[model samples]
Target chain A: MAKDNLLGGSLWDAYSNKVTTLMNNPQHQGEITEEEAAAHGNKLIVADFGAESCGDAVRLYWEINPETDVIENAKFKSFGCGTAIASSDVMTELCMGKTVDEAVKITNIDVEKALRDDPDTPAVPPQKMHCSVMAYDVIKKAAGLYKGVDAESFEEDIIVCECARVSLSTLQEVIRLNDLKTIEEITDYTKAGGFCKSCIKPGGHEEREYYLVDILADTRRQMDEEKMAAAADASMTGDFENMTLVQQIKAIDAVIDESVRQFLVMDGGNMEVIDIKNSDDNIDVYIRYLGACNGCASSTTGTLYAIESTLKEKLSQKIRVLPI
Target chain B: MQVYMDNNATTMTDPKVVEAMLPFFSERYGNPNSLHKFGTSVHLPLSKAIDQVYKGINASDGDDIVFTSCATEANNWVLQSVWIDNVLNSDKNHILTTEVEHPSILSTCKFLEEQGMKVTYLPVNDQGIVEAHTVRSFITDKTALVSIMWANNETGMIFPIQEIGEICKEKGVLFHTDGVQAVGKIPVDMQSVHVDFMSMSAHKFHGPKGIGALYIRDSQPLTPLFHGGEQMGGRRSGTLNVPGIIGMGRALELATENIEATMALIRSKRDRLEDALLEMLDDVMVVGERDNRTPNTILISVRGVEGEGMLWDLNNALIGASTGSACASEDLEANTVMLAIGADNELAHTGIRLSLSRFTTDEEVDYVIEAFTAAVKRLRAISSSYAKVGPSPGGEAQACDLLYHHDNDIVVKH
Candidate 1:
């Protein structure tokens, strides 16, 4: 969220479109039945997790093929808030075809990202990051049940700053959530780079999974990629489909040639595009044929196919031509 | 009108203290270090202010009082001076403190440890009381200083400071106490206790803010942490805050006048609030109830309700209180003082400190009791943790437990 959220509603505006959709009606929220497990010839894994601070609990179910280590099916029963339900639903969806080891590597960031419409906006606000964390923890719990190991045994990642007690994931989340571009802002928020001065960069502190400087650079790159992805989506030809009829005709006129107009105007006839309409499989471009071309027979056979093929090749594959 | 009870965090500066400081701000503004009559005029009053501050702390009425910016500064100076003295003397280098001490002591000890000084942070009992014998046992030839607090800022548990001071005197070790909470409200007689160094703050007891003093015994070998031009015979070198020092002197003098009657009145109100809490609220844990505390402080923990949330409700009702310690409450971790007293995380999260001064009255007490009762009801009614077993009805006032658990799912209540 921005400082003032020039957009109204801070928490609501921070949520991505996909999170709002899933939070309203979660698609993959249910318990995996024993019969479904038997039919797939896979073992059932049930994992229950509770957040110690907030008393929110979630039970995740995964049916996996033991030999292939693939999650044949996934479902969840969430006894938490709407954010947790959305995050759990997305986590189960992400685990549907992933192996146990592969699922184990999916962090809370991955779960939050999966629920985001795009990578630019977060699925939930910074405070609700813990719900996604619960989602991530339950995946590890389910995987641990299948592998016959403790979920806590997987916490061997290098912790960066011990003085301020900032871990690697916390710094990454702060960096990603606020779009932090500098190391000093990281210190101002998380106090990681403030203390011991060791974790600011590799030279100051002991070696770790994430140096503060490195997280800033990686997050900045991710932010740039997000901007470019949004730009790429807006600039594609689908942009024409969302335009008004007048704007669409103007867009189609920009692609036509003056020589093509001259070809029609040569025999005391002229064609001018009036409106464009789109249907399921066709785009009907209406034209006002002037100067005797309205009554010419060749206008239908020759000029019709030429305009139709040109529009289909230039704008979209679904385009068609009609003159009225 | 708002009834302020969070004097442990700070106080409403006494009007008298403010009146005394008014002239020094502009009318009598002269650098105490000047040579002219403007500077020399404040010399006698500066001596008088130091004398009053000395009297307030039971020190010999003289210039042994080194004024600092605040209690945290005074604390840091005392500890750092000991460390620096040890560096020069080439003798004992160990310091002993407790786990429940304010961060001014604990964080300084940590910084000293990073510089290769050994610190022993002794734990406290379930009631947040530290026996004097624990400090006695920890003291050795290598121990140069023992820094304890006169009373805890969070729980208001008065430590056995006089007893520990005697033991330190017998062992030939210097004892320094951060007496920020205890100085003005409680009696202090240097003639009785053998405390070698003590720290005091002005604002904790209805004085002005941004001024504090540290008492150093006349003949103790000390090294100043700051080195500058002559100030306090070069013990602490900085330009004197003339107005703040004058206000502190008058505030301490006013706080100590007819002290027994004031203490009695404060004790009644504090005790009455504690009784009302036990009678009007359910699952209340009063920290340090078994131990001797100062008369004006009460620490209570309500089950299934947050300490900060309780404070917000109190603020809404025109009441003032603190949770755990206001200075360190910005961090979301459980209160260290509560945890040191064997409180579990959830219990520690619900700790609120209500401190009173002589300025508090009977009407404020009654209003606070009613406000607190309603706030606990309001918070508990909405708490999810309280949903299973809602608040038990208020029972008759009894000896409240040192700790209480509301449900069986979590048993580490105390």
Candidate 2:
């Protein structure tokens, strides 16, 4: 079956084997017949949905048992690329035997995950993620028809590619997973820019709400920030010898300025960390008084207690703030 | 069981060209520049290959043809070298070209622009055709070259190269046409057209890939893009791909010899397919059909159906087609040619470019007509947007067009 790939060679290998099989012979991609529905004595629900950006549409057919409110049979027809057909086929398979209530809970990610040949690998590239999403939406559309609700009630994520209906979290996860560097790579993996291409950037075919370039860049920036913050936390909480002078100062200064500075400022008083000293009994932070607190009495009592407690709670429990 | 109609992407290498190339791999395989007879004996065929290219394009002198790896290299050679030396040396670094040229030319223009060369990408009319006068108006003393394609790859629209050439000469500006898609498929009189530089690829004319030729009219002293041993008369240098050159020569000869017969066969089939499709489908655009575009290429845009979905259905029906140029990235972009003509993104996205060759048969053509029609019908049936002509009546033909059938008369439009 692999050898029969009409579009041959390493180029066609981008599509998974399950995807190819389903695309070539979509087993569940036909409308259920009226006679078959009548014989089964089921109430049939048909739902049609079209993506706004790409104009790719799909029709979902469900034959539900009126007595049990269970979807007895499910079928679909997709008006999109091979990925869409394959996705709809799998979405139909996953809908089988689920009660109307249970089937509505199925999501696009669930549809995509079900097509994976292995659990660890992606079922489809990021560009094709929307096909599974479209597949997932059609089910909601059908369920909505059954329950007399709008299809939008089922969607809960911010869609990034309006044309493909690809959401932000899905794009972020894919960029992270595949290490997608460019908008073109994102388009290849997710089909986000495959249609109108407005999602690639602004001033393309049209205006888009969220472009792939911005999403990829924004997500990458957050990832870098998170990584730097994690590295800082690890070193700050380590043993005294392990903390570099810069890290120790940064840790103390951050805690004092952010947590204790406001209380001191209100009284026309302030303190600065002179040095951090570690002995056998306790770790001590040396501070110098400033402003009105230089000769104040409560500065040594409540003020000192407040500063030491805040530093201990934030940086380390063994820490002390000393006024000299 | 498939009708492969995307000939512009690549062709089935002519069997006769392959036959001529067989001996070169075993018996006559030798470097043309070798001192010994084993290699020197290959010189005669090499000379003949160069001669065939010259004769095919009507080059005034055989020496003007310099074979490169492909048209991309040739295009880069003309635009980049001219900009660096001629355009920059004179402090005149502008290049004039149309928006609808092949990417080989357009992408090279982009690279040149990034390198600080002033470029004007002139727009075309609704027919996807660029006029010579439009090019003339853009040219200045700073104009390095007017690089336009003789014919577009996406819509198969042809530019007025001869008229443009006359204008360039009068303005003292050089002209280079990316004739990769036009040569061998059409008659090219280089001298008469007054083109300063021209690029052609062998693969586009049923020859082997990785072999291309550039023609320099009147032997202009343009700088070389390739530099090595004095191969290609020191203009381009590297060891010649002997087998590929021989194959290109043979393919060009065979394609040129029966050019009229090939044109007739291809044009009739193309016209037949285009006419049948236009007659049947109500919302279809035959891009550049009214223009004097290539006879063998037919671009049809079916309203309401996106390009890749139609291609998927066609692939399912065992038919090969394309929406845009093959040299383009794998992403689904609307044809730039269509865009140049001010086509909205919808029409551009719906374009299906089907180019033919002499090898195409009437049976294959007829089969494609049906297969493509059925694909459009199938996609349009499930498409909710393409045919939103309000419930005008529903039947087998109009069901997908006017209404979609359901098991229980539930024509739900969510």
Best by DockQ: 2
Per-residue lDDT for B380-399 in model 2, tens only?
66554443321111110112
Model 1 pairs in collision:
none
- Looking at model 1, residue B326 earns an lDDT score of 17
Candidate with maximal TM-score:
2
Show where candidate 2 strays beyond 4 Å: A1-12, A16-18, A21-55, A59-77, A92-104, A116-126, A138-324, B280-282, B316-318, B325-329, B342-344, B377-382, B385-414
C-alpha lDDT of candidate 2 relative to the true structure: 0.76
Mind listing the fnat for each candidate?
0.00, 0.13
- A177-271 in candidate 1: lDDT tens per residue? 88777888888888775533545665331234567787788777887787666545644645655455656676678766533577777788888
Write down the lDDT of every candidate, Cα atoms only.
0.74, 0.76
Which of the CAPRI classes, incorrect, acceptable, medium or high, describes model 1?
A: incorrect
